[model samples]
Target chain A: MELPAQTFQVTRADLVRYAGASGDFNPIHWSDRVATKVGLPGVIAHGMFTMALVGRAVTEWAGSPDAVVEYGVRFTRPVVVPDDDQGTEIEVTARVREVTEDGLTRLEVTATCLGEKVLSQARATIRTAR
Target chain B: MPLDPSFVGRTYPPTAPYQVGREKIREFASAIGATDPAHHDPEAARALGHPDVVAPPTFPVIVTMAASSQIIEDPALGVDYSRLVHGDQRFAYTRPVVAGDELVCTNTIEDVSTRGGHGFLTTRTDVSTVGGEPVVAVWARYVIRGEA
Candidate 1:
């Protein structure tokens, strides 16, 4: 079965809320001063936080979250989340790479940040509903 | 500074079983903005042949991170938490994690090394049920940024 692609935007408030909820009180995600001091151009989002959004995109596309059997991603660049009108948006494109005899579908996933690849070499295996 | 090589193969005690719950899965899915019905409704999951609402793939991070504390808090490891950053993450799954499955994680420090003026630490956490049925294995790599 061919699945459609999905897009998502991560707002500044989203990053703040995730930091609070995940107990990852890293200053780089919320404080500009600390971020700049740490050599980043500005406050950057957590890599795992961004990766989690990729998982969301896949699950939402498959119409079932439990369908995902395996998911892996490598963070290549930091998503500079600015506190402004232009929110950081992630566009995820997924296609059915292959389907196995056991009812598992391999999904090739790509997540881009502001037109640049933030996550590379991403893939997921999902067991389809019979 | 050389890390204790003996720590490489040491496997920590298994964490207490974490019962997968529907509410928690929904919370995680919502946090990531996953609007899939199979993550929030048991009926939808049952229709898809799952026992109950299942968690998103990355949901294993919650358990793996908890298990990683055993390595992070190891005083002999001499890890500086403040300077560490997540480098990479990968997961291999044998099956989907369904609600009501009691899961435990056994964490092992796979490797510790220093190269090009940076320290790299890799840990693998195996998640399984009480009956030894494997669910997923999470591999996490962290890099300690060099201080000026």
Candidate 2:
């Protein structure tokens, strides 16, 4: 039930594409002025978008998209995507908390934005193909 | 502008049932880059005791968001979709959502208020099977920023 640790990098372009595909055109996600006007420090990625990435990390580890049975997360902090050359990176590490008698594997997930936890108490239960 | 308190306890009609499909689950998982086998393989899901491939917990968003359209389109509710921003969301699950389940959602406006010049609205949606088995409850908050 041990899961491999995984990490991912999210760029402004990724945010833009996610916004388009998800039909969430909120300017704060892509426009600095709109972000600042909303009293945010700068552009922030969509929380759902980040959660989706976390979901991907887990599914990728399982080796197929359909292996997950349940997943949830709480947005603890905003992922402030800097407009600088460095952009932003999210590192996600997942460990198997338990494997139930029914074969449901519970995972404890941690996602960091520049080494600080952006999403906390993330977890998923996936029915493994095995 | 004050919201109608009468709407607070009102529950909307149940949305038409959405039949969960393997292809849609795979598409959603792939779009999010979830490579979990239980999300895609029925044999894998059955190995884990589920009747079929089960969806990731957050997958309920697909159904509940559609249910929210009822409130968004309510003229008396006064929701400005253009000005609205997703504030927050959380889910409590009674059971996992698996493929082939015909599910319906009932949405209720839990609360509405204006604070710090921002309009805040909270809605709760209950998702269940066509047979009336409860699956999950989703709570979402939306914020409408004040005009400059």
Candidate 3:
């Protein structure tokens, strides 16, 4: 089974909010100057922030916030958040790889930005409601 | 320079307790646009059998990242914090974290590798109640870029 695609918008404001909430005050996430100096195109979203969005989609698909038993992802590309109002968008989709007799679902996840893959080796194993 | 492989399997002492706060959970859920009442309302969480507001799946990172820094900052590891980039993240949860749970983390260096003039380090953090009831295990991989 495949879950519906979910999309999320990431702006400089979102990055700032996430940084404050997560206490990951990495300047590469907010300051274009620091980001450019570090070799990024511009401000970029935190890898964990991106993973969190995908995690929301996973739980939503499982029909509960507590359904996730295992989740993992590799940051293959940076999702650059422009200083503009619209900023960047990330799209996530997942295919059910296995459904165990114990009501666990293994999903292979894909997240993309600007038509390019941002995460690889992404997978989640979730407990399903009986 | 590659990280010293000898450090693998080294487990650090448990970190100081970090009390999960409802406000923090609410803040994180709001930042991610997760509007589930279970994340913000104790009553809603109770209906779901949780003792308090439930944390989102990725919330454990807040605790584990801070805990893993013990290994990353080890002078013996020689990690260049500036060149470090997150390579991967993983979480395995025994249950959803709830507000007011005093959690402690025990961190371990899981792996270290080098390739293409870059260093790779992977750390695993086990989060549990101060009483030792396991909550979650987090794994994070960091890449230290070689000087150009």
Scored by lDDT, the top model is: 3
Which lDDT tens digits does candidate 3 get at residues A19-125? 99999999999999999997889889999999999999998998998889999999999999999999989999999999999899999999999999999999999
Q: Which lDDT tens digits does candidate 2 get at residues A1-130?
A: 4566677666677778666555566788999998999688899988888888887787677665556666667677889888776678888888889878887788898989877998777887777646
Q: How is the predicted docking of candidate 1 categorized under the CAPRI scheme?
A: medium
Distance from true location, Cα of B121 in model 1, Å: 1.4
Q: Count the backbone clashes (under 3 Å) in each candidate.
A: 0, 19, 0
**Residue B6 miss distance in model 2 (angstroms):** 3.5
Q: Candidate 3 iRMS, in Å?
A: 0.5
What's the CA RMSD for each of the models?
2.5, 4.8, 0.8
**Candidates, ranked, TM-score:** 3, 1, 2
Candidate 3 stretches with Cα past 4 Å from truth are none
Candidate 3 CAPRI level? high
TM agreement with the true structure for every prediction: 0.88, 0.72, 0.98
lDDT of residue B43 for candidate 2? 95
Model 3, B37-69: lDDT tens digits are 999999999999999999999999999988888
Write the number of the candidate with greater TM-score, choosing between 2 and 3.
3
